[model samples]
Target: MTDIKDLPKKSGPSGGWGSMKGIKRIHAESHADPAAFDTLRRQNKPGGFMCSSCAFPKPANYKPFEFCENGAKATLWEQTRDRCTPEFWEHHTVESLKDWTDHELESTGRLTAPMRYDAATDRYVEVTWDEAFQGIAATLNRLPADDVVFYSSGHAGLEASYLYALLARLHGTNNLPQSSNMCHETTSVGLKKVIGSPVGTVIWDDIDATDCYFFFGQNPGTNSPRFLHWLKELKDRGGKIVTFNPVREQGLISFVNPQSPVDMATGRETVISDQYHQVRAGGDVAAILGMCKAVIEVDDEAARTGGELVIDHDFIAEHTTGFDTFIDFARRTHWSDIEHHSGLAEADLRAAAAVYMEHDRVIGVYGMGLTQHAHGALNIAMLVNFLCLRGNIGKTGAGVCPIRGHSNVQGQRTVGIAEKAGLVPMDKLRELFGFEPPQEDGTHIVDAVEGLIDGRIKGFVSLGGNLARAVPDQKRMEAAWARQELTVMISTKLNRSHLFPGRDAYILPCLSRAEIDEQATGNQVITVEDSFSHIHGSTGKRTPASPKLKSELEIVARIGKASLPPNPKVRWDDWIGDYGLVRDLIEATYPDDFRDFNERMFEPGGFWRGVPARDRIWKTESGKAEITTPPQLTSLGYGEKDGRYRLITMRSNDQFNTTIYGYSDRFRGIEGTRDVLLMNQMDMAELNLIKGDKVAMVSDYDDGEDRRLGGLSVIPFDLPRGTVGSYYPECNVLIAISHHDELSKTPASKSVPVRIERDGLAQS
Candidate 1:
């Protein structure tokens, strides 16, 4: 591989940070082989492997090389020739690997064996599959069902997630905390309260059909590249794209689709957003409230003129309740307060309101930036209010679009991976498996971590994911992992999670989605649901990295077999032998949308699950859309009295959730480093800090807990006053587990209160 700086910068959407630069470097370091491209293309064809990155929907009718840069990187990453064998483990101990960077750990390549950590040697030693399974089962069986927590990453396929949920339920524990709990739990919780559904109501085609697209706290370029194509098309058709974010993303400014030969040859880029407004961090609710207030203003004016303008009077009267209360609240909110809170000009808010008034249908799209804050759930509720004001829900080309991160995270939840006991498909599970599923409420991600720290959870089993790095408060998280009696990780590659060894740690390598999974029945194709609720097939095309590595299905099944006695109560082996059997169980368990899982997945674009609110048929207890009030804004002032700067955590374009691809965030002008913090020029000027000044950030929590992360290079940039942005996981040390969403329990990652000071200074 070539050096990160030596790589030629690819002209595309903005937000190519650390790993993005490394990916471009890799592309430039080597030429694409036609044979390799063709093989990858063939493998990526519909009905084959799902894109291992974002869950952006692909048109069922279209069959083009439509994959994005990140998708290509994900594909090439798994296709690499690297390997991590028993010899590699013999050379490096767990303590030694802990010193390695995240990129270095994963770049070592795939794990080639089932390994168990030997406490004495402090190194991973190869173990037989039976012995590993027996050990895992023994540990799990020793703990109370509630004491064993099961965590799943979104990377797992629908088959694997379903099997995982089944395993957890079969063990009589509802402790299934998934990746969605950390990311989109706000969307799920907020939408369920208002619209009676968790997933986005809009489809890919809805972008082209809508008159207005409202983007909130999402950077499409780096996060969901595939959505850019639709945004480009929407712009070409003169449809309005309005953006609300803290930073001005390059993708939102203009994007040149590399796939379009004509546009690429002409060096022409399509402008995306018609209107862009920068809402300060933790200001999404205020911004959304401003929008709703403007709508109300327009409605009142239209009423005075004896006209029907933006307000959907008929739909509101028939489909929604609490309009009077919502209007009253909106009328009471002062515009000055909205402007101050939103950091948006009153004219801009009114302009956006005019667009909302002119458009018949509007769609609101959001990502983690909107959902990972103190008022995340409220932000979601306010967006719903914006849509509800225009009667956009349950309609074509209009609704809430929560762009999920993991490909199968939403699907996993759909297949009974939730903590809420009432949400479980109990009747179906009982009828199909002849065993009553657990009806007790389970712990979410935050709850699970707390349980671990509190000594309530003894055993940990992860079907797929890097839990240690993904969770907040890295020091506490690592300590919690160490406290666990036993920890089992079923994954495709080596990650930071493996380094934090438990009393008994077992790492089971699994097959990637790109690899062929041939079972006793036949070759199987797993299914995945995208952000838009479209389910499709994902069948691996390449051979396993190593024959010893088992598929997630196989590992989960083996563990289940070892843990549970053979009985006709559940067809665990049958489902394991054939992925279709698992799908069959899913179909039986959730007959509403997945009646014919196998047959439907084989269809052109699979099937879109039912979204009740799409038809304005809200399943809320009130039988209508609920109008929620925004929480009172309590000022959480930044910086300490010692003249330290406030630190906000963020992701580089090149990185995914916690997996670091490489160092260099091109859009942010950062290169060869992840330990740098982006600071405002004015803030630095006031603090007498220079661009290359070294600093250490510490938490400003009242408690005297030392939450300091040292060795950061301050880079002066265009940012909000008294605000500083640093890469996550590194800055995660500054955020405590206690600093989370009050309602959703999502860590306030975007709004951490920290104080940055000169490297060795007790007080700068």
Candidate 2:
């Protein structure tokens, strides 16, 4: 049915005429009208809607075409004319729809009305908003508050997420498992331990002034294409960039800025990274360790020879602790272990260290590559140690920047969508809401899924996300999903999660960020925090896709009103009438971050949520930045052993997280399919397999349960030996739910030890 063999390999720079065509094609396919042009104009501008594509902060300087190809896709996806109304549902049965691909399911279009699953008819029947809300509340009130988990996606704005969290806490539980727990939770936990802040210290201005940017496991070309414009500027300004990833991403190599008419006209490209080191999968820790070792050893040499000091002794002594122990551990780590485990040479690492030594202002940028590991927090901790040796933190253009996915993920966390009660101001919430919030740490995604299977969690309420597909252990999750007593989804479109209805299920239609949210206070503005911690307001310009659609704020408010009993302090009606009241409450809860929220949020480009770490104010217990070493210099899961290859899960250029927009991954030269695996030619030769050979992958774990995928066509590519690459979510079945970061509880989606076998035999 699919042919990947004939797919032409994508070469040259990313973002050229290819991007222009991509933008045009998506909109054309979505049947966008002429007015869509005006809509695109307002994207990422002040008093306009924010791009929900990626969480990269909007640049202070705005351009006419600020949106990227993927942003156009996201916009058009929401503005689509296709509607999955009652007529569409009446024609298709749930069993029949279950066989549809994720792309096919979402492509069916937007859900126009509230729907309730009918077990007898095996279909979804349209229902009124009152019926849906009351039914959900009835079930939620009957169950123990702890038995229900409130799940949120990054789609919801800050006000909606704040209201969602408030509702859950008022309902007497804090089981708010969100999408952040699956992606960048390690960044929060790890960075907080060292710098006392859970997010990056660098702002847009810092990025503009940075001397060097070291990118690890993040591909800006695909996930956040808008970032490439800044990277282009950084390169043109003579800044250096070093990349550490198993696969050579096109985005990291070079870029053709479509905004530059001269470059686009001449077909010229600007190089993005100075050094591209193809580190083996899950080798980030070892690589960081090796870098530290080089910096330390070179500094010792400088001391002996009276050369220039590479390590900042003054900064270290004054602004940090545990440097002595960390340096000792770095010295003890042998080069052999570093080279073998890191899949990088000693000279390469030293060269990278030299680059680091040459620059005073450096930014360590990473993505899920560093996280999504068994020891993800430790991986991040090692990176921090590397940056700390040169006093990178608390500098103008230097810090650890975790490139987060989802537009408002960080914002959601800012408003208290977390499982850990301590992360939020519990006493403040109690005082504001007149209710004692749950004190116990509630379940995260993994624990929530287990709870669903074993009956600890009887109900699930999702703000907006495809939880069924986003999580690991898909097979197990599917079965567990069916066991839920009540399930409520507040979303704009149909998704795979809608198929796995619980005994009592409701799908409530909600408005998109692009659609106007009309409340009693007239048009409303919602806020989101970008990766750089810039909190800004977003105002929708489009009419609601359907008249029945409600804003996320309205849906959350309605649910809160329906579920919780009358409380003197909690006023859901006021929030529904005006979102400014919600901002007032948020300001009260997190005063330091949200002070003067209403006035400042709608300002030109929004205000920066203050980061104390930027001012050399370490929030750590030691009162200074902490330099720490990993428990061991092991691969943390990257080393080759027992003839098993490390499988790194990735997103195609055409895909974003779990949302598949199309079949063409233009940057990777993959077309019409996502079932192909990228393997090294040497590895294939050793196994006596040729290009295009069908293969099967079985996770090499002794857990007794067989985690396997079949019919993956192999494509030869340059990868570290004993390492392979595959698209994620589809291959999520290979990852065990239990295999996750011990501290962050983020699924180890990047590093799975697996054995590749010949197709038919393995399948049989």
Candidate 3:
């Protein structure tokens, strides 16, 4: 973990010897035993556990070694021998541990027992399971339904999420906000509006059949390394890959399949992207519009000369609506405005579009790069609009693929983890559970923060995730969280959020995804839905780290039973004993998708939850795919006035969400620190700064108060001018709470306006 003083070139192409080295490093860090290696072998297998790292879909014929480097890291991390026992809590006070870094906090190891914060002693005391559940229920029962929020991370399996949602609904609250609210809510909101489905339409075979891929604002190398295998295969098969992002990510540039013997022996790497465009932060809309404009202009020429039509007019006329209105907007947009806003030359965009014109089957893949902005939903709609122009939405080899971060984040939402009442069928819920579920929309992360601050929210319950560190405006969020009446965290490991506990805070230990869960019926298996809407069962054989930890499903059921009066229709205790019962209920709720749930659990690759868009069916009011235009061709709302730079936050290779694995981001050539700022050499020169210069960053939000983070090292690197990059969580403080997407309310963590000053600069 030595610090590299100077900014270095990327060590090598993604996923060669570098991946093996990463795996080894985590093995050593986790102190993994040979048994852990045995467990790793079972990952992503038919009868084994699913990888808890990312939500990338598994291939039907997955290789013997199906897992990736990040997956290995996540697996080993959970199997670590370290335990945060009652003795550990006795030695350290919550107030004392507040100064520890996020890595240090989680690294203290897995929680071994349920613990409640004792304010008088400033420490957490171990509590009995009954005590913990009853106490939490008592607090919840006394609070207003809307005042208590039930948050979950993607870690919860399908069974767990379904039961958890039922618990909230039975308790008379729809405040079900989870981790997806921060990363990919825009995908769910935007795609559903356009094509009647929120998830990606493609499966593994679609990637195989496609000849071209348009990757946008996503780095699969660090976030979801398993996707690199597909990119490499696409490249090897003579398919083209074009990338649009603010950073020149190595994952999109090149990759070497570690599983390939020849590649490992020769150290040969397959070049991935045929063309890479480093667009400015928050400029995706303009760049996408430029490409759409090129396609339309080419179609106009074909129409005049009786040439082959580039716009797929026949497909547009039959399957979609608003083509004329959308094309007119693309036609009227000035090229100069596109170039200025996109930070890409017209030639580069036209050339990229030419690649699109050359291929009929294309897959558009994107991540948070397009989602965490003021117009995040519009960004996604515009991307679908571009695909619609070429008849790509419901085609065999073409579609929009929004790569999700969490393994079951989408699954959680599918089974009923949502804030809006309209997102789920309330009539079905009431009929099934024999209870009237709340119809009012619940609070999102942003609204929850404000409610806590203003005393409108009194209780908070989390299934997983480090809330304090994962959200925007950390300084403000922490203060608001401290004021809550009760806070409950159901997690395996300790996180920073535990430190900011409310007056009656409790930490309940839960089983990790890769651990065995034995119940009253027998050993149970859980299910997860991948990014492509494929549902599969995950079975874990590993021993639990602690005997005290309960399954998340059991915990949620116990909480429900302790809190509410017995309802014969909703059998909480029975569902806890046999998870199949929970699946049956899920099938009853989503009969179209989850029919024969238990029977299909043992299937080789499970089944698809059938997105209507895949079959050329639109569930929208118009009953046709809509290709609407955004109000403007630009995505950025905040202007870079007053010499402020657009600050973009990113994740390093060593981390997922707010969970820090190590200090190094090997793919970015950084090590031993997460506080460094990545800047263009030209921008550094103009600011009279060089590599290693310490600076303070002050955010330029319209909010009345100033948000500042100081003591950041400046590192010259590859980025667009007038834009700089830094790691997330630490830089999350610079993002104002109000600065979020208008449609989805996802924090604009990717783009924020800021001014940098030397550490010792005097105030104005």
Number of the top lDDT candidate = 3
What lDDT does the true structure give each of the candidates? 0.78, 0.86, 0.87
Across 1-764, the per-residue lDDT of candidate 2 in tens digits comes to: 01112222366578988888887887776666456677789988888889988998887688888888888888887788888898887789888998998888888778899999999998999999999899999999999989999999999999999999988988888899899889899888888998899998888778888999999889898888888998888888888898898888888877899888998999888788788888877778889899899999999999999999899999999999999988888888889988987889999998888889999899999999888888888888888888888888888889889998999999999999998988999999878877878899888998998787677888999999989889988888887887899989898788888898999999999988988889888999999999989898999888777899998888988988988889988888899889999999999999999989999987666798889988889989999988886776643544446668889898987777788888878777888899998999988888888888889899886577788888899999878888899998888889888888888889888888888889445321
TM agreement with the true structure for every prediction = 0.94, 0.97, 0.98
User: Looking at candidate 2, what is the lDDT of residue 605?
Assistant: 60
lDDT string for model 3 (68-135, tens) is: 88899888888898889999977899899989998898787888999999999889999999999899
State in Å the error of residue 741, model 3. Answer: 0.6
Tell me which of candidates 1 and 3 scores higher on lDDT. Answer: 3
Candidate 2, position 731, lDDT: 89
User: Which residue pairs show backbone clashes in model 2?
Assistant: none
**Which 10 successive residues of model 3 have the least lDDT summed?**
1-10
TM-score between model 2 and native: 0.97
Evaluated at residue 258, the lDDT of candidate 3 is 96
